[model samples]
Target chain A: GAGVSQSPRYKVAKRGQDVALRCDPISGHVSLFWYQQALGQGPEFLTYFQNEAQLDKSGLPSDRFFAERPEGSVSTLKIQRTQQEDSAVYLCASSLRTRVEQFFGPGTRLTVL
Target chain B: GESVGLHLPTLSVQEGDNSIINCAYSNSASDYFIWYKQESGKGPQFIIDIRSNMDKRQGQRVTVLLNKTVKHLSLQIAATQPGDSAVYFCAEKSPGGGATNKLIFGTGTLLAVQP
Candidate 1:
């Protein structure tokens, strides 16, 4: 009955450094999503995965942002050469099916100094 | 180019009073809408959802009303509690974002319940 969970609840990195954030979706979930939330703003879509296949990555801002869900359960979002603009809360969510209600993780707050 | 937005950025209500949060969406193609509550230092929590076909849905102390003609949605909470204080967001699921069911979220409304 555990919900989705993300690792490195808080991450601090110097500008130009690379960082990787991890997510563990709920067991048996087939659909996974990643979102980025800026301060005082709503969460924005980043990418999506249906099982191990990356169905969509349009939400990613640039090539520096990469995500992979190799096993259909664990996912990783990596950002290369961190920028101050990338400082935000990275959220991960999962659902039983597309369009269904999603369970969200606590999120990994990444700060680029 | 379509987006979701809240009519108000902040809402304050006394405890035990009814509260209403309003949202306006520009994507008419959107077929599903959801409400989420997020507290500080946490991720969004699903509250209730309403399909496009229906105008109204109720869950616990929360009720969601959808107005397709005006492209608007509203969440009504009965007897608001202090615990309900958080950022409330309205999200719409529409095609053509990243996948078949991409959700576009609205600017959240900070709900403050006074005890």
Candidate 2:
């Protein structure tokens, strides 16, 4: 079975540019989560979705950050006006409906210069 | 503001030796704990998990122990291998939220296996 996967394993963007990171969760997974991991640090929760509904966006750092999961399958994390501070690895995870055990993706590393 | 943290920044052990990684959490109300292994250039991979109800749980070659009385958690790996060398992190379920599934992760401990 295929695990969660993210696209554009590496990305380099100029400051103030917009970037979109995509995640494909496992088939039939009902829960999806996004996290940000800075260098030498653990991942921090960013947002969460249950099916197509966005349930929690509390962890998003700023208004420039946005996420959506329409059709209950694929999710996207978009960062507008990228900043140097936003340079980090963005990780996506999925789990069976509301379960605590989450399967993670390889993550997309975004480097803002 | 509760947080999770590791006791050591790095641990080096010989291959085939037993390895133990320690973690401390601030929230006593946290009930669920998990261990994850992350290699360079990859996301976290689940190793094992234990709930507050159980003091200990085991998986293939890996074991997790939870001490609720002291708000401590530990991961034990038997007969460590080079493939097991990576960053290990302990995570706890968020205590008070409608979205309790969100996890609070600790600063990872790097496990270096020397053959």
Candidate 3:
């Protein structure tokens, strides 16, 4: 209810299956982010965390794309073999620092069938 | 490989008029600038932020303008309504110690609101 919540909003993966996306921020909100939206393009930066410490992932576009925030408020963005350009929409944001202003969720479309 | 542009991708306003969205950035040691509003499936809603030493910034009705010597950035929505439509992004951040603040998005400008 505070904000930032995501999980299985819609996933169809099958190409090479292996998908796990979940984010639940907005509690302590140190900092957590993962973005990748490509249906019209906008969000990109696909990795960042400051609480559970992940630092950066160079924008993960390969290596099967993986993300974790362990306990800093919850975060996980896995996508093993899935293809089809890895489908689209997959976002999760939260900020209380890093210059501030950020709180989002409602994203997780990923469809690679 | 840095980009964030929009000479215009789509912008049709009418409701109450007054809407200007344009952004062009290529990093000049960017120092924070944001304006987002996406509504379709939801996400991105910040809507105003400016700092590169601040050229202008006003919220609520929305307003953010940062020039940073020509890097350019703008977003102003006064009366435009129809829920203000959606898809409008312009973000950038760089110039810090870095643990990865990374925010560099732009390439969005679909704000069709006519009523």
Ranking by TM-score: 2, 1, 3
Candidates' RMSD to native = 1.0, 0.7, 14.4
DockQ of each: 0.78, 0.84, 0.31
Model 2 score (lDDT): 0.95
Tens-digit lDDT track of model 2 for B29-74: 9989889999999999999999899999989999899888899999
Per-residue CA lDDT of model 3 for B1-115, tens digit only, reads: 6677888989998999899999998868877878888999988888778878888988888788888888998898999999989989888874442767768788799999999
Which candidate number maximizes DockQ?
2
User: How do the residues A1-113 of candidate 2 rate in per-residue lDDT, one tens digit apiece?
Assistant: 99999998999999999999999999988999999999999999999999999999999999999999989999999999999999999999999885798999999999999
TM-score of each: 0.98, 0.98, 0.34
Colliding pairs, model 1: none
Candidate 1 Cα outliers beyond 4 Å, as residue runs: B97-99
Which candidate number would show the highest lDDT if scored against the true structure? 2
Off by over 4 Å in 2: none
Listed per model, the TM-scores of chain A against the true chain A are 0.97, 0.98, 0.32
lDDT-better candidate, 1 vs 2:
2
The list of candidate 3 runs beyond 4 A from truth reads: A1-13, A17-35, A38-42, A47-56, A66-80, A83-86, A89-110, B1-14, B19-30, B34-51, B57-74, B78-85, B94-101, B104-112
**Total clashing residue pairs per candidate?**
0, 0, 0
